[model samples]
Target: MLFVAAMLAARPGLSQQASLEEKWRALFAQTSPAAAEEHIDAVLAACGDSPAALRKLFACDSAYPQLGGGLHRRATTVVDGETRYDVEYVVRVPGGYSPVRSCALLLAAHGQGGSGASITAMMQRGLGAEVEKYIIVAPTLPGPRRYAGAAYQEQAYLKPLAWARLNLNVDDDRIYVSGHSLGGHCTWHLATMFPHLFAAAVPMAGVPLFEGSPYTSNSYLENLANLPVWAIWGELDQKGPGTLSNVHFCRMAAERLRQLGNSKFEGTELPGVGHAGWWPKPEAYARYLTSHKRLAAPEKLVHFFHRARHGRAYYVEAIRLARDELDFSRRPQPKLRVQPGESLAEAAIRTGKQVYDKSLFKIWADLDKGANAMSIRASGVSAVRVYATEGMFDLSRPVTLRFAGRSWTGGISASARCMLTHYAATRDATAVICNEVDVDSAGKVLVRFGPSGGGETAE
Candidate 1:
């Protein structure tokens, strides 16, 4: 067609990328899983380890004529240390797409035992009219696995996002994430672990805080205080005897957000509907998602971590957690019960013993009062950084950092240096100003001091 020819001619040197993408799709479609994986390995072997080469091989740009609309199969290599393998994903580019203008991107995760193709089809129908306005991406897990675990999140979700940022005309401010059932749980994990990356999120019929799950005690709900979240559930959607019901999880999450003063969180309970109701009414979820945009930085941030698996959130970076904090987080809380005549004070004391020291290494920062300050009762934390002028701190003024019974002072020069280091690690162009400081590893680190006349030094 003339349209296809014009598109190919407009983007020079795109033919090879298009060819590779087509071959990958054909191979995936025609061959058995084992044969397809073998062919993928061979194709990726030819591309080598060069970032530029890999990008081109994956068709990271909008050069493929078939990508303008409908589902398109693409392959990319996910490198985990020395090991590397090719993975497949499906992307649906809205009709009438233009390279000059960036459009919203919806990262949809499929349910258990589902592939990118099936998920993409479901989303197209579920999202209804909203599908016409955005680009939808669905990633298939390797092999025949249904559950999305930590490995899949890194390989399928995060890697694809990095690729999309480089290749597609994506509006960074409008990137959204959503999922159903098992995918919904993955949605919660992804959104909470990396709240800064998403504008909004919708998790349907999934419970991230069920007993025996790794996320049970390590619910990073506070990290999502600034992100808009819409959680959906059915009253009768309990999957099994030991499983936590979606309704209970969503209600508890909503209540927790409310207690934290987060106004952007909402929980929608579908009456008389079961776990599968959300797929039939995609427009309902779309309504909550379309108008929201990501705030690259917020004035206040709270982040909790169980381990070093996740280190950064918005403007706050956790260098490390104290040994005691990690230990306490892992320890089970005592179940307290009040006697028949027990006073409220007595009950409080019993409960406090179990949960009082839970936040020993928690991080909290606030800049609404027009000063750069933070607080952390952390012991053995090597370093922590409070980004300046990323809407979290005022770099023009002096900073007063107080922690572990010590006070540190720094000026604009120190803030600038810290900002540069943060920019280097994250490569986030939006962060104009940021700062970092090493904490005393012996005791608590609390930012509760006055300004210093020096340029940049912790004294």
Candidate 2:
């Protein structure tokens, strides 16, 4: 009789959980960021505002389809500008895949003339015995061989990763990305833009956009300071007669990596290898990929970005960039006429100002939980957001932030809304924070909350 009564009492709780799960499904389905934020706020209002309670409610796992582990080709919708189309990707699940045991996930991309199947086969060949332990997903480029664009990045690369996280028992800490040739270029860009998503990156024979027509000479190589990067290229690889050799770019990246104190990065220039049809030892590559795990909360983060969408790394997010610093139109035109005594090289330097400085945003931050304080240095950005967890800040006491020759000390209140906001954006539970504070360059708090019932903001 008592057991029966207990079951009856638990019925309402079970129903509530199911309802919350349904809401979470819908929340993740929302495409627009603003729409997602609205949904999150609504859910917080309907549910309680306690982050612990909400996190527990949102932690429930869903049922997976019974597709007995193997290579499965799946089609996801891709939208590029006005056109929306279906693109296929290949996912290889080990035969031993089980929901009970989490497995590492490898997101690989293919170069031009290569399909998803080809990259899967390539990884399988490269991984050899190690392949069986990983769930590999390879997405073909939707149209051109460019992974730099939105369609390829959002739909082709990240969507499949989201799908795997939702459906499979993926170990978030062990996720890695790798590619070859054009895919290698994609790997470099993805690693630079989304360093938070992977444990390490293996970019094979790809060029980092340093000295190019489209991109300026300045590089975002500092962003890779925390990410473990293994870039391999042939010493003999050259793009064309007038273009610089692949080795030159690789050496430049290596130099930058050294300057940034990135011991994890390795740029390999094989003696006789060329741009195509060759790779370093597969076993060695596999060893490097499996060696590192994702750092959920790093003590420091050095991030640089050209686009607002790619402004976040670790706990620091650039909300608004300084327009005057990033606007090419505001820059003075290059000197067309050279002085009579000036050399040709001097004239070239005067007239040639090829850089993406106008759009670049720089953020450097160090979190000291022991001191309950954070120190930040920012450039080319007017506003920034700091998402703080227990690992980053002591929520119970007043948190101090020193930035731009000013210090702001305030008590940080934990909120479910803040947690859900990040969770909704990342879909990664590790990124969910206990509290968040937005401040402009002058260290004025723009928006910050205090206790659940005391949300505060400043104009």
lDDT of 2 by residue, 263-291 (tens): 87888888887888786677897899889
Global lDDT of each candidate:
0.59, 0.71
Worst 10 residues of 2 by lDDT: 1-10
Question: What alpha-carbon RMSD in Å does predicted model 2 have with respect to the real structure?
Answer: 5.4
Question: What's the TM for model 2?
Answer: 0.81
Could you tell me which residue pairs clash in candidate 1? 388-434, 402-446, 402-447, 402-448, 403-445, 403-446, 404-444, 404-445
Total clashing pairs for each candidate: 8, 1
TM-score of each: 0.68, 0.81
* Whole-model lDDT, model 2: 0.71
Model 2, runs deviating above 4 Å: 1-50, 53-67, 77-86, 146-155, 210-218, 240-242, 324-359, 446-450
Clashes of 1: 8
